[model samples]
Target: MTKSISYRFALCICVLFSVANLSVADTLTVTWTGAIGELETTIMADTSADGTQAHAVYKLESNKTYLQRSTIVLESSCDIVGAAYGTGETPATIQPIPGDDGASQFAGWPAGNIKTYGEDQSYAFKNLLFNGVFADGSTTLFGVLATYGKGNTITVDHVTSVHNQVITYFCFGQEENWTLTNNTAVQYSCYPAGMYFGGFWWGGGGGWTGTVESLLIQNNTIEGAHGQAFVIYDNGLVNRTEGEVINVDHNTFVNIIDWPKFYRHGNNTRWTNNLFVNMAANGQTRNAANTNIALNNDHVGGHGKTATLYQGACTDSTLLADGNCWDRTNRNISYQNNAWMDTPELLDMFAMEPWCWDLPADSNGVVVTLCDTMIANQSKWAGDSTMSMFANGVYMSNNLHMSDRGWNLDPVYITAQTTRTRDWLDNGVHDTHTDHFWMHQADGDKITVEWPLPMDFSYLATSAAATHCTHGGPVGSTHHMDHPAGLTLNTNPDGIVASTFALKQNYPNPFNPSTEISFNLDEIADINLSIFNMLGQKVRTLTNGTKPAGVHTLEWDGRDEMGQRVSTGIYLYTLSNGSKTITKKMALMK
Candidate 1:
């Protein structure tokens, strides 16, 4: 409890309160004496230009550091928290100010250390410690920028960022909710020289389209070099507006350099129960120019070698007739129960050889026939199977590929070596190819986890391979590491209750005008709930009645049963109570 006794207990509660009868949700602690701009002059003197005193709550004082010479322009609805000086003190940092180079002191293109502005605001950055470097260190492009707004509600809970090229950007909103929970991002610098690092960079780019009604990247932990641990850009003319969601759940992601890049377009994307480790670890130097390439080169291991857990793309055929493309027959993307591992030294550095390219000898040594016809048209366009892109209305279940070096990480033979497939793992009506378990066919042992990762990046809860890869029971990222313990210092993290009889999965799931479907009952049940489509029929019927005994939420507005609206793709809801039934799937992207 240092920092001069937490700044003399926040100056003894501001000399026993009475700063003109504090209100607007009180709290204004700000005690960083070594100030430069003094936290934007105490948040512009508790902002209130018409945001009705902007619900102030600056706080920050724990192990003090705040300097920040420029950006901090939040303009309204506030709550910056971070004062609890107890369990291991620290946290209260906010860097930049010594030779400040916050991305060249902002002139354009993402430059923030806290930048939000107007519109429907709500911002909150709890237990702060964003040290994106500066104060004589370097890097720092953004830590909380909230790219212009429209219904904002941002919330970077338990914040921690380190190098930060982008740790929380949020963009072009229309409904916006973005909540990066239990945050920790540690992006190893590659800075603004050629962008891309992100540990939470949301959608809608330049031309700024809209819609983002919710993007909760849960239980965050993201680590190293991260060329993507949730970039999800959009703006090909934006789609999914009926409830729009992008929930990358239960995150943990370690040596990241891939997986979660989903640029160009998206819709109801849900990569659930996440915990990928060493994914593409700088796949041959991320923005590659052959930085010593050779991890068994064939461009180092099969299928897009690392960045494909649905890295959506679209080369504008007028934005694919405006459905804005990521079109898994209209993006209802879902990769469930995720838990990948990798590190048989990164799966033998992505093993899969054969295709030794050295080509270039033209001075009569005879190799260059235009470099062997551009290497056989790039290996026949990388082993084309009709240049694949299979997986429609995508959904893969019980995911759990592993390899703490026990081999076999086979994402369906690495997505059949290219273009994209999970063709429902060979279509026997969805998941088959032995329904996901690879680490040499499971059965136990090898699941150790501990290489610069354990400050709650947990995995060894008596691992029988993490209890045979459970999801819904334990999967990955169960949060807690940066300032955990009852989250004091203006407490925040809590809400998550619901034990037993579940049924979730349906919040903006490719939705377009409405969607919400929670469940959980463990008691007074008589439920039915309905919805069906994809030929199983039953178009709508939301709830046949009697529910009680706990959590229930229900919404669906993309109507039917006479209310109209229904067309799009994949549906199926079904909850039931007659001896318990459950069904799931959703997607309605109009």
Candidate 2:
């Protein structure tokens, strides 16, 4: 069951999964008992025949720690979910077995902790803790390695990783939908290898192909990462069809040594309502000369670029037939309503550079500025007038940056602050809270009230700025601010227990087709479960009757009483027991 797969073999696997004739779909559940090789053995034995049609759910024992000694190749779609006894109970944990050379079997590509290769499949990992700390500081382990798939839906939700090199890495081909939400990564110090989250070139010359239908990275808390946060790259071959998107929203990134790097995606890419703090820490000099001029503050604090968007070389003329090349204009990328706290003066928020050949050329083949091209193509390039094209095609607005100006009123400090602020303003970045004091916040400058742990970025409630900040709520990630509870397993438990009435968050918040909604009832009571639109109109009543006490779960297939599919938007779900009522929100993203 232990094997290494090459790129060619990986591609073949994807093709095989796509063309294979699957049988009647069935759900298979397996329980683990902390034994070595048993989990993988059970999975392979049960699904050895016609795996594509089987929906396997591998349930790990509650709060137990399991050692993954080798890569587990998933031949089929499945859900690996950990069990918990009750509220505040710890979930099962999976960590790499300690090795002599600090290298575990979960190294990558050829091997990894968990590997899945297929097309048009659904894979979910949830309610589990992954500890990737190694002895010799090896940075090769990938919690989940997925490769070469199209129209695949992958979800990594409610998972926690500690000191992991890469929590998840998707390589080669395109995915219909990929979501990384409600996850927590603590001390993710990976360097000289990979990113904490994203895909990379895996032994290919031209690089990954196809267009991602949708990518959602939301509600995650990344506390400390040494190298990069997200590094998604797409070869400039295919353009996403209209309405496709890559959304990185409502996440908190702090103590990041480097920034997110994205390339050659011409879709509606958005970075919205995110909170960043203490970025570019200790400079971006990773065992090399500090060549970055922006971060040259005697190697103290704030001395690097925040992000870079590159238009990869789209030199293939054959792709031009369908207009499947990198879009140099980058009109669909946007950064809005984001907030940065304790940012240094010189860090450029974003930098966009066209491919070497993508620079505009005149009829005589002479290089010209983007402004020159805009003048020639007036109808095509008409939008923001203030931008000087320094960061072309990027629309930035309503972004807030607050830095502490300490007692040192040096001319260099003042000049750097004003210069960056003016540059942003001139480039069509409209900050609604802009004022004279923004550049000289001597009295107002302060650090987060909850420093280091549970870093709270909420402004004072009395301040008028609080109302304008972050769309009626706080600006940062609201979940898992404090580190997740450590894994503590009770080897012997009486039985399944329920202590309170609770309605848990939906499995996949922005879901397509269907999603699960679960709740706990301490005692038998008459309960009513219904879904309502934003306008307070009830769309469907899932259940309305007396139910016994225990954990109750149901699935909403994104439909109404008339059996017609609902439009994409936020929908409210209410759970009422005649006395106590609990309401929550879920999104149906078609």
lDDT of 1 by residue, 1-590 (tens): 00012111121221121233233334568777895778876777665544333334678887777777767667545567788666656777777654333445644556667666665555667877766556644435455565566655666777776555554555656545565677776534433223234556656433353445456566777665445665555532244444234656666776555445543234456666566765544333211223233321333223331232333356667556856454444555556666666543444333423223444676888762211111112211112211132354445576665533232233322222111112211211222222211112122322211122223355554432343322224445555323222322111222222234556555533345687786766567788878877567788888787766545777889888899987656576777777756675555544
User: Candidate 1 vs. truth: CA RMSD?
Assistant: 24.1
lDDT of 2: 0.49
Clashes by residue pair, model 2: 295-303
Question: Global lDDT for candidate 1?
Answer: 0.51
Model 1, residue 346: C-alpha shift (Å): 27
Evaluate model 1: give its TM-score. 0.28
| Top model number, TM-score | 2
Model 2 alpha-carbon drift over 4 Å, by segment: 1-29, 53-55, 85-88, 98-103, 107-111, 134-140, 191-211, 234-239, 263-267, 282-306, 309-313, 317-322, 343-391, 403-470, 480-590
How good is model 2 by TM-score?
0.57
RMSD to true structure for each model, in Å: 24.1, 16.3
Best by lDDT: 1
lDDT of each: 0.51, 0.49
